[model samples]
Target: MDVAEILSHHILDHHWGYSLGGVELPITTHTVTLLSVSVIMLIGLYWISKGGASTLKRLLTAGAEEYVTFIRDGMVLPNMGTEGKSFLPYFCTLFLFILLTNLAGLIPNMKTATSNISVNAALALCSGGLIVYCGLKFHGIIGFLKGFIPSGTPGWLVPLIFPLEVISLIIKVCVLALRLFANMLAGHMVLISLLLMIFIIGQLSAVAGVGAAIPAMGLEIFMTCLELLVAFLQAYVFTLLTAIFAGSVIHTH
Candidate 1:
């Protein structure tokens, strides 16, 4: 294939080799990757919660426990405060699930679930629901609605400010979804493009391909490492923002 065709393949969605219902509802490679990752995560959870006498068992479990402790102490407790302690499990699950999915994309032949806008949107919806629920629980429905009103505002501005605040709240949730989805999608795209260049150059001329492959492949490896860090960073950013949103609404100070 030519360079354009090779690059195009990277940009397009990949399909499963075969369809279950004759294409009525085709399960794509992404779906299978997501399912596989989910199963591995569930197995990890079992090991995380279980105990064994072997040293390897203890070491693995310790790492998982440390991760849980770190998120609870570092993210949830700090942002949510003491009153929000009960929400630790919720945030922990969110962090780990997103982290796993993000890392899954780096695995050979695996797709990143978080890179899908639909998946990210669903996660944002859940966070938004929690924000609203916490706000209403801490303050009554009327009080929560009134929280949007700025202090010492003239009666004339109340009407305008109220609608604006409502819109802002919805936008906040949308930003959350887009932030995760965009980052994950863009990172993978860059990596794919970088790797595709080597193949494209080589197809045109063997010598040029070999020469281009050296730097191209080197850069691809560097980007892969950077992407790994981004995977963790993006997951942490999403969870941190979710906690902050909920905390702000719950306390309102």
Candidate 2:
């Protein structure tokens, strides 16, 4: 089934309305779901703060700290260097936001915001715009444009390579947006289809349906774990790519 149909089937809508300016607004099921996730994350932070260096609390905090440090040291610093430290806050927020959004979907009755293209595109635009802004700030407009064309290309190739380079640059942003959207959307669709299959089989015969359900339930559990990994991996990939893009502009090859 198509993503829209699948999402519409599962994503409960709270309400719809027109704004004062006549813009349509959807109070999506996922929005409320995300509010709860935000509260949970905040509570986690509070727990860490209040645990006061207890062994379990320290372990939880250490795990969280390690993940953050890994992203900074292994992903961001390698590409953007010491100057990359300045961008850490933005990248960290992006990672946590997407991670939480992905995790929210695993909960019963919750919609995945990352499954929505608009949401993923907004994130891509935010990251891409930051790259462009940093590029411009680091190397004036002329320099930023010049950074697009690879050094040592023949003069004749400049005419072709320049436009190709620009297109490639734009494609990077498009890929970033589509990758996360497609992954989340596809995962949810698979889950829904699996569930539907179990229901269909169960209606045919109780025994057979239960038999079908066992494997499907197992797969769903596996996918849930996979989704958690994807959540962190995608965030890392996005931030790492952004750092690489920004680095390329700052220190053009």
Candidate 3:
């Protein structure tokens, strides 16, 4: 059977709920599965990084060093100026977390956190909220509020422009959340569905099925690599966009 068929059967077999602690929740198989995997990966990372110079130590150090340098040189510094240096740790953490989460899904019997809407939404909110917080902190309440008003608008247009600008800002947050959630979710769905095709076709004829399965397997492998790229790209994009918005508020140009 294809991965999608298996997932569909599993979902049908298990009653799902979105709740915890007696409170209703957005209970999804994907969310629970991915979160468990993420926790385990995080623990593994922590354990590997805990000791002095050993093989695991060197591996962890090299991985972290490369990731940190990538985010610092490629993403933050160019966009946010010298002040961006202070944000390096936060960006690096976000990037590694997402990258690990994305890669975990490629493992047999593992789930991807980025494929869950709740997970992606939480990540988006963190980045978006930081943008708002930094904006207010650097610019103060009045300056932050005044940011909505464009430089050359007439007094009469301020009333219309202000609300529109505020709404647009709100839309940016929504788009950020939706973009990540949709991309990750869609990629997984496509891969699973393709696997399912191989299973169904194989049932009809052994040779035909095997032929189809070979290409499908190759495509899945390619997608696994693509997801790795996406994991880092989304992390960098989120942080870079946040810095751009924050910088606009601070510099007001």
| C-alpha positional error of residue 235 in candidate 3 after TM-score superposition, expressed in Å | 2.8
The TM-score-based order of candidates, best leading, equals 1, 2, 3
Per-residue lDDT of candidate 3, residues 139-170 (tens digit)? 78898888889899999999999999888877
Which sections of candidate 1 miss by over 4 Å? 2-8, 15-26
Candidate 2 per-residue lDDT over residues 202-238, each given as its tens digit: 8889899999999999988887788778877777777
- CA lDDT, every model vs. true structure: 0.84, 0.79, 0.72
Cα error, candidate 2, residue 23 (Å)? 8.0
Models sorted by lDDT, best on top: 1, 2, 3
Clashing pairs in 1: none
Superposition-based RMSD of candidate 1 using all C-alpha atoms, in angstroms = 2.1
Q: After superposition, how far is residue 188 of candidate 2 from its true place, in Å?
A: 1.0
Q: Per-residue lDDT for 114 in model 1?
A: 82
Best by TM-score: 1
- TM-scores, one per candidate: 0.91, 0.83, 0.80
TM-score of 3: 0.80
